[model samples]
Each structure stands twice: as structure tokens, then as C-alpha cells.
Target chain A: MTSEFELIRNHFVRPTPQAILGPGDDCALIAPALGMQLAITTDMLIAGTHFLPDTDPCQLGWKTLAVNLSDLAAMGARPRWALLAGSLPEVSEPWIAAFTDGLFACASYYGVDIIGGDTTRGPLAFCLTAIGEVPIGMALRRDQALLDDDLWVSGQPGLAALGLAHLQGRTVLAEPLLKPCLAALQRPLARVELGLELRRRGLAHAAIDVSDGLLADLGHILQGSAVAAELFVAQLPPLPTTADPVLARQCQLAGGDDYELVFSAAPEKRAEITALADHLALPLWRCGLVVGAAPGQLTLLDDQGRVVPINEKGYDHFG
Target chain B: MTSEFELIRNHFVRPTPQAILGPGDDCALIAPALGMQLAITTDMLIAGTHFLPDTDPCQLGWKTLAVNLSDLAAMGARPRWALLAGSLPEVSEPWIAAFTDGLFACASYYGVDIIGGDTTRGPLAFCLTAIGEVPIGMALRRDQALLDDDLWVSGQPGLAALGLAHLQGRTVLAEPLLKPCLAALQRPLARVELGLELRRRGLAHAAIDVSDGLLADLGHILQGSAVAAELFVAQLPPLPTTADPVLARQCQLAGGDDYELVFSAAPEKRAEITALADHLALPLWRCGLVVGAAPGQLTLLDDQGRVVPINEKGYDHFG
Candidate 1:
């Protein structure tokens, strides 16, 4: 019988150049760069709850690391190492091989080392802890947003949600949009470069990754910074033209899993932000502005400056 | 409905003085001490696999962190920070409260700070990533043992298995031993102090924590170090005196879930090892010797110097 240890050694053990010690020992050893603080985050993905049981093992692996990397991006940290803890119902060599392939693909892309982790027999689930590094006291924080700061987002938001909707049969999309949306859902890129640039240039005052939709995740910043936000619905980036306007709006406002960074910056830094966007060749959308009104409150306005009613804020696992 | 976020904030969020940034952020921040390398490890515990579904939540929580801490102990590292990712089938305030309390209790004992993690709704499971620190190039490794090294084990090695056996109704234990045995199973200490001392004093050449039974875990060291071992079964530490001799032998040889440290040192260091053990007021059992025989080979010998027949090596999740 193949034991968990052999499975790990066969599939997950790889040469980790970044680590002083790697998978063979009890713990992997890493030496963070001088004058840098380690940034750490963990995320868990369950089979039925986080992904479809029939989902491709490769995509599942990619998404698991991608989501955790997104957290590092939000913190303006440089990805360094990760630990993956997974529970599998049974041993399937093919499944594990494909999963590790996809996982290492993303890790290689982001230049993050898979240092160490654990594997066991149980339900299908994955929990990844990503470690990164940032200059001391330079890591972005949710509670540092200043009132009157312009709220910005990287890349088009809500594409992953649309993909999920299509997969769930709640919506149907055609051609080019279908593939991109599905890719967004399956292999969303963490905005690591954008975050690093923002921090290195001292631009963003506060930031958060949009995992639980635009409004809900931004609300985290609002509550943390004790500020309110006013988002102009008309100014929001356009969704796929093929989607219905109402469904598009709902997806943009309340759907999760976008893995885009939403940040707040001083209005005076608009020129710098534009230059940074130009350098990265990624559109930086100015969607809203931080306000001093009721803390944690969010207001959405139409083109006519009238309030738009929102029934749901975002996805709630228990709700 | 109680959302995953609220559950985390209410139960898992706390003041983390050790971390530069704690929970409620995208990622927690920590600074390793100068000239130290960060040692990291992760472990996953799943319901019906790592623990019984009816197990106490508090004890489960303690064991979750304790097991991960044992990994750090084996590497002779000082525990620093941890990230916990968990999935729960349903929300239970009391259960979460008790679990976090027990987790924190163990963390406080080891001086580990809960930095950050994720919570989701799904089947009950937990994956914890623990970080520790050791001076550069000073970590104890399984591959460092040399031929003729004295193999030593800390504490009673089979008490946990005995406790589990009693709980499983495989054995009947008297009152005096029952509570302590159960405690050994449920709340086994990680032997962190001993590991630290061994590394600090430069006494041990190789070390590993006994999580998967002495023979199996020791086999890892032998294989990694490219050496063989001869274990004197009669010299093995005794379990509770009340345990049946045959059953105790089985537990000592093949049963798992003991968090004691097993290490190897040069034969000439025997006096220093004894002195250290005397200082700590803990028995250090010298039960085996590393040899230049076939790599990864292990032989068990009785008092009469005859080979002892072995059936099972250790617990194998898939086996």
C-alpha cells in the first residue's frame, strides 16, 4: 500500500533552491532577505463548497495556490514560499500528478517555492499557506485608507463570478467571452506586480483583494479604516457586452472569486497611478472614493447620481 | 446566518503581539531574528481520519497545533507563529470558542503566535502551518546521522498508542493509568525543550519526532542518513507497568501518535547526553545503535541477542 509519505515524496518533493532546507525534513528552512519582514496568509478550499466535484484536478490545483497568492498581492508582498496541506479521499496517482503539475506551474510562474506541507487521506480539500516578504513597515494594510482617497481596482472585476454563473447554468455565454471568463474562474492571476509597484512607489494608502466581490471586500477596508465609500455605478468597468445589464451589475457588485486587487490612494497621486498603469499595461479603474460619512457604509450611484438599491452585499458561505 | 468571516473574527481573532500584522489583514507580517533561518511545517487533521467525529473540540484543537509543533521540535527550532485554516460543516459558537481556546493554550505554552489563516464552511477539518526559527546551519536533520551513532528516544514512546488502544476498547486499563494514558493520547507534549537543548549543546547529530511510530519514523532517519540500526528491544523504555507485555510491545513497535523526540548522537557523547537528561529530569532512552549495514535496514534484538520477528512496521493511512 502506498503510504501518505511516499505519495508526498513522489509527487510533491522538488528541489527548492530558495529554501535552506526542503521537504525531506520536519520543517523547511528559509532565510528572508535582510530588512524584510515575512508576510504570511493561508486559505482553505473544500471540494463541494469551493469547487465542483467534477472540476478538473489541474484547475483545482491552480486555483488553490492562486487564491492564496492573491492575499499576498493585497499585502504588497513578494511571493517567496508556500506550504500546501491537502486531504484526499483516496490515492489516485493520475489525479495527484496532474494536481501537482498545475500547482508547480503556478508556483513557477510566480517564482514562489513549494517549501513544505502535509498530505493525508480524507475528504477532498486543500489548505495553502503562502509566505512572502516586504520591507519592514511597508506592507499594505486594510486600516490605513484615508478619507477622500480614490478607490482603484486592477483588471476587470466579476469575470470569475460570470464564469461560475455560466457553469451553474444560471447564465449562458457565447464564444470569446466564454473561454476568458472560465479561465478567469479557473486560473485567476494574483496582482503581485501591481501591488509591489504601488508599495514601492508609495502610492496606495490601503488595499484588499477582491475575492468576495467588489462591495463586500471593499467594505472590509471601509470598516477597518473607519471610512465610507461612494461607488459610481456608471464609472464601473463594463462587463462582457453579451451579458444582460441587470445580471452583469449583480455579478460585478456581489459575486466573489475575482482575485483582483482593490486599493485606495490619495487623489493627488492620480498622475503617478496613470503612469504605473501605463508601465504595467493593465487598466487601473477608478471606481469610487473613500468618504468620511457613516463608517463601513457603501453607496452605489447611477449615472443620474441617484442611489441604486443592492439586495445582496456578497457571497456568505454560511448564508 | 453566521458567515465564515464573522466566525473567524469572533473566535480566532485575538491580540497577536508577536506578529507585526495579525488577523483581519490580507497577510500577517513577522520578522525573524537576525542570523536565524525560519523553519516551517504544516499538518492537516481531518474528521474520521485524524480524530473521531465525537472527539472533544478543545482536545482536537490542542492536538492540531501540538502535532505541528512536534515537527518544529524535531528540527530543534523555537516555535514562533502559526496559520490555521479550517472547514466546518456547521457553525457552532461553543465549539469554535472551545477549539480556539485550546489552540491558544498550546500556542501560549510554546510561545507561538497565531498570525493569520482562513475559515470556510465544509466538512470538519483543520490544516495548520507552523513557523519557527533556528540559528543558521544549526537545524537537526535526519541525514546527518553517522555510522556508530547512538540512537536515543525521549520520554515513554508507546503511552499514546496504549491510550488509543484503551479508547478503542482493544485493551482495558485500570483507573490509575487510564486518565494519564488518555491524556497522553489527547494532549501529548511536543518535547520542544529537549530538542532545543540537544541542538543548542551540539549533542545530537540527527533527530526526528515520533509521530508515525518509533520504527517507521526511525526508518526515515536511517534511510535519509544512509545507515542501518540495531534496536535492543529489551533496552526500550517501558510503558505503563499495568499494560500487558505483548500489547505494550506491539504499541511500542508499531502503534503511532507519539510526539516524543528520537535522535542520534556519537557514542562518545554518551556522558554529555546523560548529564543533559539529568539536568532536564527526563529519561533519555538509549535503545539502538546506528551501523554501516544495508541502508534503511532496522533490526530488533531481544535480551538473548536473537532477532525479534516483526509483522507490521507502523501505521500507514492507505495501508
Candidate 2:
């Protein structure tokens, strides 16, 4: 078991910048630029529930921060500061250090400060509350998508699901998908740049991070916007290599922990968006279109013009 | 065990006026008032580590918030919004509901919105990341106190320590300490009014909220300012009722969790400080005077000019 002091001294405690107070006291403090509203979100990754028991400590740490960044990305807010509370199964000094390295790599990648938090002995559970900054009223919401808008998702999908399959021994991942797949699971990138670009262009109708699979995540936009969506099976960004394309698409729609952005925008802005995509050099694949508010329906169209039966409903915390 | 949904919907799901995108979404969308710098802070409370197993749910919830409010208080910032993450031992409906009620009372008292967070199945743990608004460069810091300033503390000390002692069956509370003692533990109030008063009058040099025993917490102020203090034992506010005055002062020196403000002010501002204290209707007791560059030293003096031996330290998570 890792002693709480060793973990604190090694991983979580760091000298903060002049403007901020680091963890030690009852609270960590920060001063945000004036008049800007804060964007805040929290996520909990339990050892057995969110990750496998054998998941590497470094990857686990990275995912914890990455998932929080995905939430900030969804709101078109740049990462700023994060508070972490970790409940450990036992004390492991090396594990804490490795985890801290991975977590800080992502934090430094996005320029977020590690502010305040706590560590305690318990089941291996980690929770992060990320705070970000955006100009007041500029945050994107799921309900803002308009009908008939074209939907875009950054980067490819199903790689994380394939990674999980490989981890679980459900399938043998070939060399091509192996690196991409594992990276997808181990180090899912948050779409911070894409979100900011869309917000800067003032073009996106609505946006959400694809944390719980594309279909389920998009279901949030549909439910909130009071609209349905038409997802084209063939239009998804290409995966590495598919042993079965249908299963792969299903994974894209149902697999979890892919932190790509699924968002909607006006059809008229299509060319502008494409130009912006070229500028950013990240994928902006248009995978679907918004539909009228018929309520409680999401339909998928195949190349053969048949509606396929979907089996996976994505992951649920309790269900 | 409490299901995740039930735990979240009951304890955390506060209906926020600024929650354009509420829970169940990828990120929360909020609108902060324009022209105010956001003051952010994070505080964590761990089960067993911070609270006893049989602690009342309502008190746990209230103090969880009061502690964070104390941070905002220390910064001389106005509390506006909060993010909460709770890890639960199991789903207890009544416990959850009572906890929510207690938490909301604090939020309502301070006019803060509950924005976002995560709930997980683990040992009881909570992290609250709070945001406030203050004029840039106007917030207080530990290094701002001048060496020759007057040292002050609000409210009586050692009550919460007595309350906890009673709860743990280590001591018996008697008379006035019983009511204030229990209240100190159950509904620790943040000195929000005192904070505002200090800023309004421009009388306070530096300030901190007391959680760790005064000796240890004041040590922080001394370390940061590189100054020292000679604390007069007789000047400490009466402990309500004490069988032995010497022991009571000893408790005052090491007592913790009296969520009051300890501040420094120029000696010339004493009368104005008294006026502000009367205006707020909270007692303001000048307990000592800051000593110049006796650097890194804190001493206690009795009426007979004897130095009291101080040994007990504040509560520590690892210890």
C-alpha cells in the first residue's frame, strides 16, 4: 500500500504559479479573467467499472484527466484548472508517481493547472472536477442544434472499442489497429482545438464530446434539441482496417470512451467548415444530418437502404 | 446500495438558473456575470479521514460546504457557483436526501448555484470546486500582512474540538460549550460578512480561515509573510465556560475547525475595525500583535510572564 504522505509529496503536490495556490491547505485558489463565465465538469473513473483491473497505471491516470478535458471541449471552453480526489485500493508510491506523470502530461498539453484535491485509502477510484474559462454566453449546449443541420465528428471512431476488444481477448487486433486502437483506449485525445475552432467560426449549432459512443452521445443532442437524426453507415470516418465493417460501425455507434466531438452545424456552412478543417488538419467528417422533432427515434441507414438492428446501447454508470 | 442515478439525482442534482446544459450532458453550460474576475477554489472531504463513520449526514453535508465557503471568504470573494463530486459507500435514500437539504441550505444562504460533478461507488468522499468573483488584485493573500499589524480572530475557539471530542466519546461537553460546540461541528458558519466587511473598510492586511488549529494555521501566515507573532493568552475570547482557564487557553491554541476568520489590521484602524465588527454583528477579538522579524517564531505569554508549552498539532489526513 502507498503511504498517503509519500503519494502527496511525490505526485499531487507541486509549486503553483504566482496567481494560483496549490494543494496543501483546505482549498486551492485561482483568479480567472474578469467577466468570463467558468465552465466546470466532473467525472469518476472507478477501477473495475471504468477500466479493467490490469489496466496500466499510466494509462489510467491519463484517461482520468483526458475524460475531464473532453467535457471541457464539449462546452467550447479551454482547459484551465482541475481538482482531483483519488481513492486508492492500497498505497503504491511508484503507481502514484507514474499516474501523476501521465495526468500532468495531459494537463500540460492543454495548459491546465493542477490546483487542489485529496487522496485517501479505499477502492481504486479517481474523480476529477475540471474548470475552464469562456466568454460569458459563448458556451455551446446540446439543445442548440437546429433541424436539418449537418453533423460532424472529429477524428475516426471505433478504435477505442476495438482496443477494448483486444484487451478483453474478444478479437485479435492486427498490427494496423493495434497501435491506433490501444492509443484510442489508453490516450484518447480531447477535441479542444476543434471545439474552439467551431466556436470561433460561430458555425456549430451544437456540439458534444463522444464519451459514451457516438449514437448514445448524439442521442443527448437529439433529446435536448427536440429533434431526431439520420446517421449514414458508410459516411463514418474510415477506421484502420476492418475484419467486419458492420461490426466496426456498430462499435463506432455503441462503443464507449472515444473522446471525439460530435456536433451539428448549418448546411450552408459546409464549405466554410471544410476550409477550416483543412486549416486545422484534424478530421471533420460529416456523418449525419439533423431531423424534425418526431421524438424518441434515431435511425441508421445502410448502403443497401435497410435499417440495421443495433445491439449496443453504450455504457451506463448504473445500467 | 444506492444506485448511481439515485445518488446523483438526490444529493447533487441542484436545479441551477445558469445550467443551460445540466447534468446528463457532456459538459455544463453556465453564464458568469460580465466584468468580474472568477475566483476559483477546490476542497476535498474524505470519509474516516475527515468525518467519522456515524456522523450525521446533514452535518457532513453542511460542513462540507462551509469549509469551501471559508476559502472564498479568505479571498474576500463573493460565492457564486459550485461543483460537487461525491463517492458513496452505498445508496441510502434518506441519507442522500438529508445531505442534499443540508448542502442546499448553504448554497441558498450564500446564493451559489450547484453546477456539475460526479458520483461514484466508493468510500464516502466529496470534492467541491467553488467559483467566486472579485476585483482583480483586490483579493487577500497570506503575504500581505505587515509585521507590526494587530492579529484578530472571529468567534470563540475550541468548541468544535470539544464537539468532536464528545462525538468520539473522548470527552463530555458542559454548559454553553455544549450548544456552540455542537453547532460548531454541525453547522460551521463561514465568516462571509466579516470578509466583506474587511474589504469594504480596507482594514485587513492579510486573512485566512481557521480549520487547522490556530497555531498551525497561523504558522502558514507567518511562513508566507516571514514574520512572527507574540500571542497573548488572556486576549483569546472566552471559551464560553471552562473549569480551568489554563487548559482552556491551551485548547484555544490547538483547537481546529472553528470556521472563523483570523486577520491582521494596522493598529490605527482598530476603531474602524470595531465599527465594522459591530456592523456585521459578529464578535471581533484582537488576540495578539504581529511581532517584527522574530522570523519563524510564535510564542505564547501568560499573565505571570510564563511561556506555555504548546505541543498538539492540527488534524492531518495522513497522520
Candidate 3:
């Protein structure tokens, strides 16, 4: 029902760098640096699957780009150009403009360009392919974390999950405390600058962005790095006023859509990595340590230091 | 239903140059020579919009790359890497396998790589964003086409349109004549090497692929070049066969999905262009003349020296 074109303009369209040929052409042209290669990633968001029908188009655009940029951030690539393919039920100029406007606002703020995209009639859905750059062999991957490495995460956890709870009619929970988490879900900042900085400084051994909830997403890193990780429950960052422990815990463990970076650093390089948070003005939290357990193993400890069984899995497109 | 991952592996996962990253990663990385910038383009195909339901997935894959390649061709770039995003209704593994097979075949044939892509559950749809390499200020564009220039096109026209007619239940379209057109439409070949060769030889003044009908797409070049053009009906490439004049004329003049290059060249360079085409094994046809018709005009001359009006414009995303 919201204006689509306006939504697009308010979020997606913008004048990017001179090297980029932004949207409205058959494809976008981007200029990569010498000795560097182009890094590309794509993800799709279906209306009912990715967001609620009542979700704001502006936020949807932001979230769409956020998720894609998160992928680039995971690889320690600097954001550049993006292509969007949006499926629509009908032609509504305003809605598209708003959506694109949000998209571009985020894109421009992140120094990214909306190169070329497709607009078609179908179920309301959108896909974005983000292209970026990194020096050859410099991209950080999830397979590099080593045992005894300290695992760190950027920003707080469970905010996005709390936001979902609020959307699902859980009024008994604190609203103001969950606002930041909701915003985290809605407008996650792709840590491109931070990611590249980490790689440049040789700070991160492995990196990934939390998308399918911390437990599930981090598992990819665990599996890739062929290591295990142990999380200290007491060390998890808590929202300012999320008084209900049960809600907060669920948000932390089971909620998805937190597009924040989780990376591992050598224990010796911990101080330098912590300085990254201050320099970049982003909150970096040390959440755990890589353990000698077999690959793909993950354990959560509570106050009594007993293991917590994880039964809930992250969102799966097919599941 | 087709297996989702298989669809990708068979259709999209192509054997790329060892210089580029494989498709198994978050992003595909490609390294180009220093000082050469990357040209990128993105296009989407909707089920009912770009292709028909019964349309062969293999041809769709080829045509998809062809159209996107045409964009890079127009820019005078060397095709390098492509990222794919497929949104499917059924996630059928077989269809995806066939589709990806076709996609990879085209990528490998064209010397491009399938770097990274995403698949999702939705209406059957696909989008591809491609990257190519071009030296600074060397890419051909519509604005450079000039007055009194010879307008040229590559390969035969009307075949794709004929093919489309066949697909649309035009049972009347018979003979060896109609088969080529169908093949042309279904398996449109991109003039990748031709474009690169032309750019290397500094041949074309302006260029664009005829995705929209010739009249409409050619108009873009004329308008951008700030000149008028006289399209000679006699100069059009011969129809596949001596079919019904009306159908052939309409198909050649207004039908789209032809991935051939149309460009303007100086009258003096005609022989050289032709020789180059011969060397590249691509058909080059001299179709019209670019001249000052009215400072800004596009004309189509019919038989018997009559000026014909082309009112039915080609495809428009929103128009």
C-alpha cells in the first residue's frame, strides 16, 4: 500500500563515485584499484519471509542493503556498487521511490552506489548484489580462526530479536530497552570500513556477520575455522533496560537479523583489536574464545557453568 | 521441483579463469590489469516479462548472459565475471541444474566466470550483474554517434522475433525460415569479441545493443549523439527466408531480444569494419545512415519511398 517509487528514491538511488555508473543503465560500471579484485555477493528478501507486510519500505531498503553489505563486510571488502532486482505486484511510483530513497540513503552513507537493477511485476520481493573491493588474498574468511584465538563481536546482541518480539505483540516486554535492538535489525551498519581496517591491520583471523542469529551464524565460522568456541553468558552485552531475563536470553540466542560483525583475533592482538572499536566509533564486544574442541562444536555457559542445550535453529529459506 | 543447490551447480557454477575466485565463496574475486577499470551491468528476467514459461532454461541462461554482455559490449569492455541471483517458485533442483548448466556453458564460452550468487524461494526470476574491463575513456557510448555516419548492425534481425512468434503459438510460421528466427531468439549470441576487437581497433563511433526494437533502441543512439538518422529499409539484413513481407518487416523492425551490436562508423572505415567482422567470424550489416534529418529525429523508410511511423515502442521497465 505504501508508495514504491518514492520508497526507492528515498532509499536506493544516489550519485555514487565517479567510477561507478549508477542505476538506470543496463548494468553498472565500477572502477577497481590496481592489484585489487572486485568482490561480489548477493542475497534476496521476500516480502513475507524477510519482513512483515507492515514493515516500512524505508526500513526494508535499509535492511536489504544492510544484509548484503554485511556479507561484503564479512569478507573484509570495501563497499562500492550494488544492483537490485525488485518484484512488484503492481506499479506504484511512490512506493518504489521511497524504497530506493532509503536504499540510496544507506548506500550513500556507506559510500555505495546503486548501479543497475530490474523492476518487474511479481510478489513483492527484492534481491541485491553488492560488489566491492579487496586486495588480492587480503579478504578475511571464516576458515582462518585458530584455537586460543579470542572471538569478538561488533555491537550488542539480541536487539533485533527483541524488536521481533515487540512486533509479535509481546507488550509485556520493555519497549525502550528493545528500541536499540530493533534498530539494529532494521538499520544494521555494514562494517565495511571496520572490516577492511581489521584486515589491513592484520587484526582478525576470521570474520563473519551475524545474520541467522548468533548461535547459528557463528557456527559457520566455527565449522569453517575447524575449531570450537565457548561463550561466556555473563559477558554478553545487555540492553540498558531489558529487565526480563527470559526475553533477553531468547533475543540473544534465537533471534535473527542482527547484521553485526563477529570476528576472531589472536589473544596477543586483543588490545589492538579493541582500539579498532574506539577508532571507528563502533562498539566491539569480546564474546568468547576459540576452544580446542572438535570443529563445529559450540557451548554456552550460564551462572552455574552448566552447558545450555540449543534446540532452536536459525531461519532457513526452505525450512 | 528442482533441487535448489543443484540448479545453481549445473546452471550457474561455471569453470572460470584461475585468476578469479570460484563460486563457492561469499564473493567472487577477479583481478584485472592495472589502469583498467571494471564495467559492471545488471539485468533481470521475470517469468512472464522477459521469457515465457516454456522457454528452455538453457537458452534463457544464454540469452541472459547475452543481453548483459551486450551492455558491456556497448561500453567496449571485455567480459570477465558475473554474479547471479535466482528467485524461484519451486526451487526444483533439476530445473536449476539445467539452468545453471546453460549459464555456465555461456560463461565458460564467453571467457567469463560465475563468481558468486544467491538463490531464494519466490516467483521464478533471475538477475545477473556482470563485470568487464575497459581502458579509460575508450568505451563506446551512444552520445558519440555522429551525423553523416554509416549506421551498421551485426548479424541477421527478425529471427528472434520469428522465434518468439513460434513460441507464442503462431502455428502459421512454418518452414526452415522460421526455425532460424526461433533459434536466434532462444539462443541470441552476444558479440563479445567483436566489441572488444572493435574497441581495440578504435572502430565504432557509438554503439548500443538492440534489446528494444531497432526503431526504439536506435533512436536512443541518435538522440544521444544529437543527430538524426535515416534507416534504410533496403539495408536491413535479409530475413531468414523470403517469408510474408508484413511479418518479416514487423519482426525485424519492432521485435526485440536481439543481442547484436548496432553502431555508427565513418563511411571511410566501412571496409575495415567489415574486414574485422570477417576476422572475428561475426556478421556485420550496413543498415542505415546517420545524418542531420532535423537536428534531432529518427526515421524509418518503408518500401515505395514512404516514411513509416514506428509508434509501438519497445520494452520499458516502468513506462
- Pairs with backbone N, CA or C atoms under 3 Å apart (clashes), candidate 2: A1-A91, A2-A91, A2-A92, A35-B35, A35-B36, B2-B91
lDDT of 3 by residue, B1-319 (tens): 2333444444555566644666755566777777777778777788887889777887887877878888898778988888887777775666666676787778877888777777766777778878788987677777788777999988876678777877787635777777677778887788788788778898889888888778767877876788999888877887655566777778777778887788898999988998997898778888888887575487788656678887656555444
Off by over 4 Å in 1: A1-5, B1-5
For the predicted complex of model 3, DockQ is: 0.46
Tell me each candidate's TM-score: 0.98, 0.90, 0.91
Over 4 Å off, model 3: A1-14, A20-27, A170-174, A239-247, B1-20, B293-296
Most accurate candidate by lDDT = 1
DockQ, each predicted model: 0.77, 0.37, 0.46
Q: Score candidate 2 by TM-score against the native.
A: 0.90
Q: Give one digit per residue, the lDDT tens place, for model 1 in A157-214.
A: 8888898999999999887888988999998899999999999999999999999899
Return the TM-score for candidate 1, rounded to 2 decimals.
0.98
Which ranking of candidates, highest TM-score first?
1, 3, 2
Task: In model 1, state the lDDT of residue B199.
Answer: 95
Q: Show pairs that collide, candidate 1.
A: none
* TM-score of model 1 (first chain only): 0.98
